[model samples]
Target: MAELKEIVSTLDAELDIKSFGKDSSFSRFIPRVYEPLKFDWQTAFEKDFVELFNGLMLKGNSTVGKVFLAVFPTDKVLERFIEESNSGDLLFMHHPLLMECGDPKGKWGQGFVPIKEKYIKQMKEKNLSVYTCHIPLDCHKQLGTNIAMAKKLNAQILVDDTLNAKNEYVLYCNIEKTNTANLISVLENIFEIPYVDFEGKKLEDIQRIAIVAGCGDVVDWMKEAEENGVQAYITGEIHCHIDNDYGKQKYNQIMEYASNTSMSLIGVSHSASEYLVHKTLMKDLFEKNFNVETVLIPQEKWWL
Candidate 1:
């Protein structure tokens, strides 16, 4: 069995965690924002992973026989991990267990829904450890969500920058002559999604594109694409909830902006697009460097 700390250290080295900027405003908005401990590099490294997730170590420690990767922490995914893994296995994900802190105004919790006590108990019994990497994974040069999506689409990179002050990469690229319908088909195949949501422009009008994977429907990012002469903006999820009238109105406004600018917006499922990083890029990373068995446990599709 490989020591869990060793594997985490290897990943940290590969991801260059030390170079991550902790002072940004976006960093503060993350689930668990922490002040750096005044310690040597080794001590800091020991505390970094735990502190990053606000000391949420669901269960287990030290030695790990296997590693399972997923885009988010869900009961189904965790159950699968428990079934597939022996004692002392690690579940590494992009999102934390508590996606949002309890807010009565928020849609999910409605007040406060604590992490399911049963799941925590199950994980502890099964000796499962959970770790999360959010913005860091999204910003990684090679394995980042946006970079992976751009590579999968075979687009020529025009601009690569931290997108819209979110500390996540947003890429602008030029695709070889292809219509919007064909482009959507290509994306569906690549991400293994049933359908895509789109608005603005004709199929024949798209060439230059901007991609920001996983909840990249921010107006600033879209504006950036338009400013950079991008004819298409490809992302995972837009705020177009059918029941929420305000959400629909906001989406319509974005569509109107796109129409005015002669731009097209194409949205794939958030989980599917981000899953590319774990299934393709990170799988290779683990296979190349570690002896432990690594598996990709894809998150369930939210849409039919």
Candidate 2:
């Protein structure tokens, strides 16, 4: 077993969390709600993230016997982790709270939801730790969300994080030329999804594409990708189906841009988009290097 600080620090150093200057809206709405308890997990977050944003949110035990990997700490995921994992086990996830970005086919969902207070109390009692790395995971080279997707497609990364730190979350890849229809089929198989939510061109010579794993619904990023001359853009959520004000606005804006652009827009679902890194990169980081046992908790219904 490795010390929790060693594991947390290793992640901090590897991802260079401080340098990213990233922010999260995970705890934005309910600051007052969790403020009363003054939990260390709420306070131990890096100060740069406004004191409750990223890195090790909790320090449950001195040593970590096993590490649980997941995209987010959803209710079901946490419940399962608590039930299966032992004391001193660490939970390393991409998001601190569950980003219920919604299932286009099923009941739509509201945005970020905090872990149930009961679960939080239970974890504390169990001496379980929680560490979340969002953009850092997205921005990593071999271990990043976008890179894993590119690797899964057997595509070559033309421009990676080192080349464009400004747009580190985005990736430019070169793939065997294929039409949009076939490319969607390939994505469906890779992500193990029934269907892909897509729009735009069905071009045959789609040798190059841009990837932004989680949410590619940003217009500015889409414009940047368009400027790069890629024939397609692949991401988790093309138009976020989150049932909220910002969600509605973003979906509208992105849909408008995609309608006019010549590039293909592929939405493989947000959680599915980020899941690969856990299987490919994160699994290796803990099991092979850290010499710790790992248990991955896949999202039960990634779409919602």
Candidate 3:
């Protein structure tokens, strides 16, 4: 068993962690978070990004021997692990510690600037190394967003309409050729969520399907399913628009109408549908001989 730092170093050499992104805000800081978990298994992050991301891809890599789970308030969370584990290991995370969208050159151009700054600043101080895989991890066929969830529900895949290979997708899956109510029941049972909006007129013909994680912004992807006769749609969240004529109430009414017209929409909270992506990933990692741990971040916000 190696110390926390040693394991990080090994992963650094292997994954080229140093080259993940230098100019990005987190480039200089994230490594500090991974240092402490090398030898100490007990000191790792529990529910945050590290645990979530590691859960998804831990099985694919044969080179990684072990991993320490660490949940850090800041980057300094590395201190907890370094005291426990040994070398030849590393840390992986969900929820990007550093992601900048828009303009990388402009101020606040980095994706999620404020959150990145707060976390990365602490990481730099702790001398820890961290890595995160968001969409890519979610879209892996063997261990992807739709595949994992679909398997649990015994859902038959209709299509994997991913615009990009980076986990951007609208996955269509069918439930044992059931009615809308039965399909909804199956989804609730499979995901353990209590409710979803089912607007399909005839559930009996609902043998085909479509679903996606994250904000369902890809209208084209959703449309493709409708074009192909997908009766039900599942997604992480919903989109609402309001105008003077179409207030919040009106907007929702229109949305309901929309749902009733074409495909039924099942709005599963983004994290709820995607949680297995990490949990199952972690299971695979543990099964693959890499000592791994998980941390789940609490949902700070919720829809009213």
Candidate 4:
């Protein structure tokens, strides 16, 4: 087995994508994080497992030799996973099968309810390796949704947090001299989003702005952006309560919070944010081995 660093180096070379950068969303991947994360590739998989799990890790110094297509499942989809395979073969799913967020100090507060006995037992028996990419995939520099959207719109990076090890948000510029009406028309034509709201009259010097993939319920952050002189905050969704309670608007409603401070909110289904990752990852894998095939899980739910 190749050393972990070697594997990472291989991935870097093959993907041609930078996953870490300074001033990242949360400064997500710091040196301290590197210390605790392990890169053991020694786990063995069933003979057939290699067809199932290898190639998912884009570039590695050593060959994992195990790869496969994983079907994505939703909470209600409830397709029983083939758990009893082999350990160390990582299962990279698009959705988190075991995720909940809160203080783990209490049982109720713990994130991610464990799967039922039938599923857990099956996984333990098969020794299948399971993992989910979720936001990480959506935010990946090369395969992420933000980059794809930017490409579709001919947008430029105003603040590129794509490479941040912490891997948080991506802020890209759409149009500088374009009028708001034109910008809105362009966005509506290109994306699955239905509408965009304007806070004030069309904006000038509108070339500068920030965008989040889905849901901007993080109101305080937008407020902070306003203080920083940001012309607009574009996102998929924001809390509707902000309208009646604070802004008196509908859930998808876009608001002009203050003069000289405005935002454009674009609401698309969450799946639209990361659907491109499947194809992007496939391309990376193909560079390493052309015969290898990649597939997107069928369970991802969204339109367009």
Best by lDDT: 2
The C-alpha lDDT values of all candidates are: 0.66, 0.81, 0.47, 0.42
TM-score of each: 0.79, 0.90, 0.56, 0.50
Give the per-residue lDDT digits (tens) of candidate 4, residues 190-210. 554455433444564566555
Q: Rank the candidates by lDDT, best first.
A: 2, 1, 3, 4
> In model 1, which regions exceed 4 Å deviation?
18-50, 54-59, 98-114, 159-168, 240-256, 302-304
Off by over 4 Å in 2: 21-52, 160-166
Per-model tally of clashing residue pairs = 0, 0, 52, 36
Position 182, candidate 2: lDDT: 93
Clashing pairs in 1: none
**Top TM-score prediction, candidate number:** 2
Q: Please tell me which model should have the higher TM-score, number 3 or number 4.
A: 3
Give Cα distance to truth, residue 159, candidate 4, Å.
4.8
- Candidate 2 per-residue lDDT over residues 1-304, each given as its tens digit: 9888788778888988878664545546446435655654435444544553668876688888889989977888999999998889998898877778888777677886767778988988998998888877787876888888988999888844434324667788889989999999999888888887787877888998899899888888878887777799999988888888888888788878878998998899999999889877888888876868998899888788
* Clash pairs detected, candidate 2: none
Cα RMSD (Å) between model 2 and the true structure?
A: 3.0
